[model samples]
Target: MDQTTSWGILAALAALIGGFLWEGGHWEGLIEKTALLIVFGGTFAAVAVSYPASRLRQIPESLKTVFRPAAPDVPARIDELVELATIARREGVLALENKIADHPDAFIRNGLQIVVDGTDPELSRQILEFEIDAVEQRMENQSKIFESAGGYAPTMGIIGTVMGLIHVLSNLADPGSLGPAIAVAFTATLYGVASANILYLPVASKIRIRAADSVQFMEMMLEGILAIQAGENPALVRKKLTAFMHTEEMSFARKKEESEDGTETEQTQTKRA
Candidate 1:
């Protein structure tokens, strides 16, 4: 789970609510149900109108992805690929067919399968690149939904405030009630702006960040697949995969590989408020 992300969101809420309370504001003032309905319900209605059901269906999964992104085990992946390289060198490329079947990850499995089928390297790269692009485009679309919601929410809030103001004005004879009514009206604005900044836009950003990480991981897998197809040395394949890793990841992969054989093998493997 993304503790930092969860904690950041909590912090944002705590600070906002804490500051409000510090200023002597009561919880009742901020708990205007009508304002919430306008900001949240209207925002959802607008987003529903903007996107198709198929796309909207992705919201649950998108939120899941944002909060619990599947971080690739880079070092373990490098070790796996290097092990594949060793097998191919020892047993020939065709020997990988059975091993590839048991692999659950369709991305790398399909790419390696293509290579095993003797497809041209460039074509394999193109196909995998196209897959990456498709995945990226889908991710882009998903994030845009939240982004669009963020854009719409503030407007919905303003509209709610206007509606509330209109209601307040219609009761002009109740001079004593004007202040509280006006306060109630303005709560819509607060809900709108706050949800936009702290929820919608931030969720959209987290989704994009996680998507980029996933795409890069797939790219790394593609490189390893190609190296294996080319019959590169196991250590060299590990090295190529390691190119995608950070300094710390490089050390982890190296240590893990060495621990396996007592010999060094080189390989390497978001926030919302």
Candidate 2:
């Protein structure tokens, strides 16, 4: 589970509800079944009309990705790839075959299998790169679905609000109910705006981020595998793959080195003293 996404959603809901209560608004005033049905149902229908049946089926999985994002250990991946390169350099490329089954990532495993099988370097790179592009396209499609829903949600809410206003206007004979009716009519607008900004749009953004991360990781793996196939030095492979690490990862490495240097200096001073 992604704690940031989970906590962020919780924090947003808490702020919205807490602010509403602080403003002396009753929670019951926000509960309008007709408004909800109109906004949510209409939004879904609009999205359905916009996308194909096959793409619609991916909504569940895409939503799951929003809450439970993939957290790839990039540094660890680079380290593992370097180790694999070392093994391949020490033993022949065929030696990697024994470790292929033990490799956890299917992408890496497939690449290694291709290398072990003595596939043409150009062909292997082409195949892996194609797979990478395909995966990225699929993820982009899924994210776009949510993005389309977000775009539709606000308009659906407006439609619901208009419907409610029509009913309210028709019943304007009772002046006493006008205030409550107007309030109820606007609830659809609130639902639409809130759901779009807080849920749909954010989920689409998260999916995009996840997709980018995935593509970066795969690209790194492709480079590593290709390097191994080319019989590059393990140290050189490590240097090249390290470039894929995020800035934060690089910062952490720098901090770790500084701490180690300080520790060594302190030890030397104490011994000299």
Candidate 3:
């Protein structure tokens, strides 16, 4: 489960409950099924009207992303790339032909296959970057789908609230019913605000984060592939690949120090020569 998504939902619920309690509220007489049905139904209807059928089907999966984010294994995969490159350099790229089919990651596997076929590094980079860009564009659209729903949610909520008020106001001749009717009318607004904040906005934000991470990781893969094709040493490749894992502050600092030391050593050797 995605910790952020789970924690976000839990926190939202906690805050709502705490706020209610702090306001001397009780659960009794607060059940507003009509309000819920109207707001939720209206919001979804509006969304359906706005988005295409394929995107409509994806709503559930998008929501699931909030709690079930796919783990980004790109950083760890860098080491595997280093190993594969070393093997290719030692035994020749042809030796990797059989293993290409066995690679679970289609991206790395395809790149290896292309390398074995003696594809130009420039061509390979272009193709791979194109594929990555396509994927990113698709993700962007999905994120926007949720964001679009968020834009509609609050307005739909208000629409529901208005509908409820219309019914309530028409029956104002009955003085005893005003309190219950007014409470029910307000529930739609509450539902709208809550769903927008807890669900739509957060999902969009998570998608954006996921998109950025994915793009960075793919760019790192591109670098590694090019380095492999250029016959760079595996250890040097590993050091370079560490740049993709800038999420680790310690790794960034270590890489910086190592780079500085490597330059110093090169300068010293040149002076001695």
Q: Point out where model 2 deviates above 4 Å.
A: 251-273
Query: What's the ranking of the predictions by lDDT, best on top?
Result: 1, 2, 3
Evaluated at residue 52, the lDDT of candidate 2 is 94
Off by over 4 Å in 1: 256-273
User: Model 3 clash tally?
Assistant: 0
Candidate 3 residue lDDT tens string, 1-273: 888688878899889978887898877535578877877787778878888998778667766655677766654677687887798779877777887888877777878778878998889999899979987887787888878778777887798789988999898899999997878788788888888888887888888787787788888887887887888887788778777775674365466558867998999999999
The TM-scores, one per candidate, come to 0.93, 0.89, 0.87
- Ranking according to TM-score, highest score first: 1, 2, 3
Where does candidate 3 clash, by residue pair? none
CA lDDT, every prediction?
A: 0.90, 0.89, 0.79
RMSD of each: 7.5, 4.8, 4.5
lDDT of candidate 1 over 1-273, digit per residue (tens) = 889779988999999999999999999999999999989999999999999999999998898898887778888888888898898889888989988788988987898789789999999999999999999999999999999999999999999999999999998997999999999999999999999999999999998998888898889999998888888999788878988987899888777656854532223211221
TM-score of 2: 0.89
Better of 1 and 3 by TM-score: 1
* lDDT for 157 (candidate 2): 89
